[model samples]
Target: MKRLALILTLLSAPAVAQDAGLAARDAAEALEAASILLDTAEDSRDRVAALTDTVRAFEDGLAAMRDGLRDAAIRETELTRKLAAQDAEVAQLLGALSALGSRAEPQTLLHPQGPLGTARSGMLVAAVTPGLAAKAAALRSDLEEVTALRELQQSAAKTLEDGLAGVQRARTDLSQAIADRTDLPKRFTEDPIRTQILISATETLNGFASGLSQITENEVAEVMPPIEDRKGILQLPVRGVIIRQAGQADAAGVTRPGIVMATRPSALVTTPTAATIRYNGPLLDYGLVSILEPQGDLLFVLAGLDAVFGEIGDVLPAGSPVGLMGGDGGDIVSLTSEGGGAGRSETLYIEVREGGTPVDPLTWFTTE
Candidate 1:
């Protein structure tokens, strides 16, 4: 009976060893299954089931697989914490992406307060599962792409707005400039200086046209009556007022011009048929003035003599010296010449232009 008991104990020892090994294997399998559950679980209910199953297996083989059970528990704890944190972060990321899509919000890379894409979701997955880290990187690239596209769209919108504003400003300024120019002509007409310039231009233009026809000394000589013969007729030399008759005054208010000779009341001034006379007359209030009646136009005879020599109706014999200066000065002359004379004298106011268009006398008399 003692020998039979010993053999039975040796056989039971092999069975006991086999049972312990099987328990260790089952514990390892439970740990692996729990890890997979943590990696893929989307909710707390699933995670709880995996955790319960793993813990039950660990307890069942506690005595035979203590070390393995401890290791599995540690792994499960770490994976659980990581997964929980990852889920929370993923939820936040999803919320952020949703907020970015709202239309009423202003534009921004993060929607003013949140992310613009689901790429952040991969970050959570990576925290819990190292094997998925590469996928997380790919998701990050997607986030960057969407962000860049949004920024480009916003930039384009701003550029178009700015361009329209610039165009409007330019149009307004151009209109103002046109208005300013239109008012310039009226201003020029009101200004004294500008009026004077107009007067000068008018004279220049008239003179250019007048140069085409000129009278000659021969014409004047032919028209003049014979001086030596008493039967010769006397014609009006110039048709105009005696603007200033021959006159003068002494230290006690004496006499001058007419004192020397007789002048007609109104005469028709004429020129010789073929003569060129450039004569400087007297120094009157109207400075040293002159008269030139060429031999081309018989009716054209320049006769504002600030200085006069020949008497009224006197035959000058064509190119002969008519007279000496009788400058309009002092009292009487000032009434007529005003600023036209040298210092202010009543001088001849000659205006004999075609078409009745009055011109500046100075231009026609001198080369300048």
Candidate 2:
């Protein structure tokens, strides 16, 4: 019965070992699947977690591998220390041998040929010879360990380099996404707040662009003369209805060589180009008047008129009619310079402009 029991126990041992091996294999397969899932994860936080788990698995997978490396380091330190100690002993032995050879009284230290002499010499040599042999063997082993450690460190460095490259790629993608978000604009890129400034700058540049290539400030002199009697032009100074016309000296107290005009009370006034109307309040003795700079050298007419026409600031061609002489035409009237400083009285109410400066009006007008 005892023999039978032993046989049964022996048969069960192999079966138990096989079951344990199968269980360990299953665990390893599961871990490998987990690693694959971790590698394929998309989320950054999840990826980091997976990488951590992978590192943990690697550490656990070959825990003995790490132990072996640590053991190698410890052994290396131990071997190095032993080698140093051996070298010291060898050095001491060499010194003693040297002293023996160089001694002047060598005869006193000499050992006669005998077993006792050989024994003493052997004792001194024994101090370093075996230790040196042991150190050489250990150094060879240490070189192998060093090579292995270098390989391991290289692998770690490569892994870190690859991981850093992946991180940099991710950062670049994110930055590009952000840049694309900010670059949306239909025309030239402009934020709402900056539109006004952009428009203003564009308008200012447009105004300058026309004259930029050819026009100069000095060219103003050609369009406007400085002297009250010199040749140039001036612009009309206001906008209003024509009330008094030029011509007809036979009408009731209203006879000026040039036109006398008036504007409604609500007319808007603005300076045209560069001009200065040379007049105080009630001018020409014609009633509230001012002269305009001339258009160009042009003919002047007289005596055939009926109504007061032409408003202030009215841009006129060379022979534009001022107006007919007198017909009702309320208290509204303005007289402009016609020829010289003479207009019924010797009062000169002329406009002037030149070179960004104002010139005289009567200079350019010719009498008709």
Candidate 3:
């Protein structure tokens, strides 16, 4: 009986993969949402924001589809390897079962030891047969699962391609919508000549930041709600991974009082809280930048963008798109690369200042 029980090892392995189909279903739902949004895009009050949501949905759907396919491939390979590894044990079980099953009960009952031996043999065969049936059923289940996973991978390829195309279209529409937006209220107008003079005279970021108000045409301050109360609980301006914290030295051994983040190419940048745009334009070596004031003397400076949205002095709502990270919209390249890793290829630098002094941004924003 013990020897026969060992035969079950040829089929014994708990399901190693979860329902990969669930991920594919989630992807389908997200893609559907994107499609609906695109169809009704022109009716949207804030087309820029609406299109941003659509693009994000497509991105999520593509990621989910890719993950589902990857998981299915992995599971199928594991099952195949397991089956190959236990081939010898499977043959052993089959041979042993054939001998036991080929015998007739009546012939066995006519044993040399008479009725007692015959009855014992009969009992042994009956006891082993049911257990064998259960194991055979489990083995069949695993084989079926492998087949299903293989078929899923094939179908998901089309879904993934559609998601990619949809997201690209949304991105293009979002760019156009942003270009047409002109309804935001302005706190104050900017003076280009004064800003140029300030930039030319300043030797460092601190000097330039300290004199930000000099470029403004209006001295009258707009009274906004208190943001100090929301300190230490603000969201990040962009979705990314923090590569460097405040005061961290880089490869050049130069330290900066800011947070450096790595993000996917062309990722949307947004405001963590409702704030007025203090400045928005190219400055110094920073590609393009936007300076925001969320409170009385607090400034949030975001640098290294491919494009900047909204004019200087425009008051933006929380989560408003400020700009896009520099990239040509290849978000899935890293996902399919040799490393099989995720993407975070663009760099964004964020600096927070209070009362003309630099502070740790992590203290004000929560990160994953």
**Best TM-score goes to which candidate?**
3
- Give me candidate 1's TM-score against the actual structure: 0.16
How many clashing residue pairs appear in each of the predictions shown? Answer: 55, 19, 0
Question: How big is the positional error of residue 285 in model 1, measured in Å on the Cα after superposition?
Answer: 19
Tens digits of lDDT, candidate 3, 104-136: 557744658878987887788778878866766
Question: Over 4 Å off in model 1, which ranges?
Answer: 1-293, 298-320, 324-346, 352-363
- Per-residue lDDT tens digits for candidate 2, residues 57-104, read 432322222222233344445545665766765576566556545333
Q: Name the better of 2 and 3 by TM-score.
A: 3
Q: After superposition, how far is residue 160 of candidate 3 from its true place, in Å?
A: 2.8
TM-score of each: 0.16, 0.22, 0.78
**145: Cα error in model 3, Å:** 2.0
TM-score of 2: 0.22
Ranking by TM-score: 3, 2, 1
> Which candidate gets the maximum lDDT versus the true structure?
3
Ranked by lDDT from best down, the candidates are 3, 2, 1
lDDT of 1 by residue, 239-342 (tens): 22232223445356754322111122111123322223323333223343333333223122334443333222222334333322232111111112212222
TM-score winner, 1 or 2: 2
True-structure lDDT of candidate 1: 0.32
Error of 2 at 319 (Å): 81
